[model samples]
Target: MKKFIMKKKKILIVLMLALLLASGCSTNDTKNNINKLEAENRLLQEKIKNLEKELNSYKKESKEKITIYYIKSTQNDFVLIPEVITIEPEPNMLKAALEKLIQDKRNPFPKDTRVIDVTVKDFIAYPNFSREITKLSVGSRGEELAVASIANTLIKFPGVEKVQILVEGQTVETLAGHVDTSKPLGRNETLISIE
Candidate 1:
């Protein structure tokens, strides 16, 4: 009986040691898992910070400066002059430039005229205007000034070598029956004056 009791006591001690070892391993695994989660959280926070900085920079670039041409009457003749204006950035910057010209008070274009759209292809800019562009009441000189102003303004943009004025999406021969707008027009440097 004494020997049997001693054997039972030895088995109990061995079982208790196995239980302690298992609990210790589980505690170590829990600590390792917590450390891994902390590392992953830190990486995610860094990515969020980087994305916010990029968004802020994009917001700053949202405004653009564009040059618009307007007619300025010289002592004896009319000429086109460039005026730099700030506007909201647009995917179609050529259209934005034309709209600014139409809005300028110094422009001889019809008051009711509107810029329908502008499309570019192969270094040519096509500025489509509303029908009111045909209602140019200003005479021959006014016609020249208007066409030159439009052409010079668009040509200054990159990749725009010439301008083809359109009225309601149709190619027109003239804006006021004076300027030949049947073909694409290049920049008229002669009509532009700095003074």
Candidate 2:
């Protein structure tokens, strides 16, 4: 009977030691998990704060008015006048400007002219348009005037030094089979009518 009691005690001690080790490991894992979660939460909070700052700055800029340059074609198709226009405010300023420019009935661009996409990188503007641009009745003088007009108008925007016109998201040799548009073009102020 004494031996039986000693064996039972040994079993109890071993069970207690196993339980202690298991609980200790569990507690350490829980602590590590909690610490990792806390770090992730801090990173997310910082990102939210930065996004809030950017939103506030954009809101302020949205209230500021912007001026856009446009081309006003004269009765002579070869001549164009540079005109300045202003709008209250818009998120996409360049897009808005282009929309207004196409609205002018005097320009060679059709009333249905559409801008597919526009992006500015490294001070260059890539304006993708529909194939209607190539459908126009084009002459050397008319092409020169129209191309220069659009290029000059786009360059008026801050940070835009040159423009590369695209059609259906692909580069073209020329918009009207006249000007060499195989590459991006800069503003040509000389094309604007002095008047």
Candidate 3:
């Protein structure tokens, strides 16, 4: 009977040891998981802070506005177009218009060309061209459409009279294939069709 009691005691002790070992292992695993989650959370917070800083920088840069000067032809003489009477183009609008002009496929000029300058005087509109554009073979309708598009867009401003185009700061030979390159452009009035 004493031997039997001793064997039973040994079995109970073994079972207790096994349970304790299992619980210890589980506790270690839980601690590791918690540590991993903390690291991930910290990394995510850092990323968010960096993104916020970048956004703030962009806003600050855009707030530094750019100004352009224009000259208007008056009945008596030429005058500096008043700064109070100016147009502020949305950044994406001109880019979208250029993209549309290029994607039309029907346009004869190279799609890569850019509008260097756009000026409005006495309700007339003018757009200066890049050297790359002057090298391209543009048609009359294409030039007219380009001028009309810019003029009509600018006229939406308070005191714009018209649009004229120049290439590399100088009057170009012509726009696309039509319209005299030498003359300032008159508002087409029809370009208001662009929504």
Candidate 4:
């Protein structure tokens, strides 16, 4: 009876050792699985970041087409010519048109002229310019054409019916002592040459 009891104890110890070894192997497998999952999660996060950057870059490179006016001198006189150009979109399209106009080399505005701001109310667009606008080096006809260039360009927009040119945010009497700019001007189709 004593020998039998000792043998039973030895068998119990061996069973416990086998269970412990099997559990240790299971724990190692679980750890390896967790590490692999963590690595895959990091890789997916990096791919998402890369996709977002690519989308932003594509948005920045996109451009739209708009028609801006430039002065074209004919045999006897000059007229505003419509020129379609590509520019980045702006929240205020009126301001964008004026800025594009100023950027053109053939535009009537004096060199160094800049657009301060543009506001629209009651179908009228008020474009305020820097003091450089007053320095136009043209005669009365040229001044008329310059004023028409602005008025005509803005009038092309759907909601704009007239334009009131301003110098430094105040209503100006005239641009270059020719055309009266104190009041809002309408689109002058006469100044535009379709050709």
Best prediction by TM-score: 4
lDDT for model 4, on a 0 to 1 scale?
0.89
Query: Residue-wise lDDT of candidate 3 within 2-113, one digit each (tens)?
Result: 9999999999999999999999999999999999999999999999999999988777665422222233334753332212222234564433343344344434556777
Give the per-residue lDDT of model 4 (tens digit) for 1-195. 999999999999999999999999989999999999999999999999999999888877886677888898899888889988777778888889989888788876777998999999999999999999999998998898888888988988889999999899899898898788999999888888888
Off by more than 4 A, model 1: 1-61
Cα displacement (Å) at residue 116, model 1: 1.1
Error of 2 at 103 (Å): 1.6
Predicted structure 4, TM vs. truth: 0.75
lDDT (Cα, tens digit) per residue for candidate 1, span 1-195: 999999999999999999999999999999999999999999999999999999888878888888888998878888888888888888889999998898888997778899999999999999999999999888998999899989998998999999999999999999888989999999988888885
Local distance difference test, each candidate:
0.91, 0.78, 0.56, 0.89
- For candidate 4, the clash count comes to 0
Q: Which is superior by lDDT, 2 or 3?
A: 2
- Each prediction's TM-score versus the true structure: 0.70, 0.61, 0.41, 0.75
| Weakest lDDT window of 10 consecutive positions for candidate 2 | 64-73
Worst 10-residue stretch by lDDT in candidate 3? Answer: 79-88
Residue lDDT tens for model 2, 39-127: 99999999999999999888776663443334455675455676666564766777777766667676677767787767899999988
Among these predictions, the greatest lDDT belongs to: 1
Residue-level lDDT for 119 in candidate 1: 96
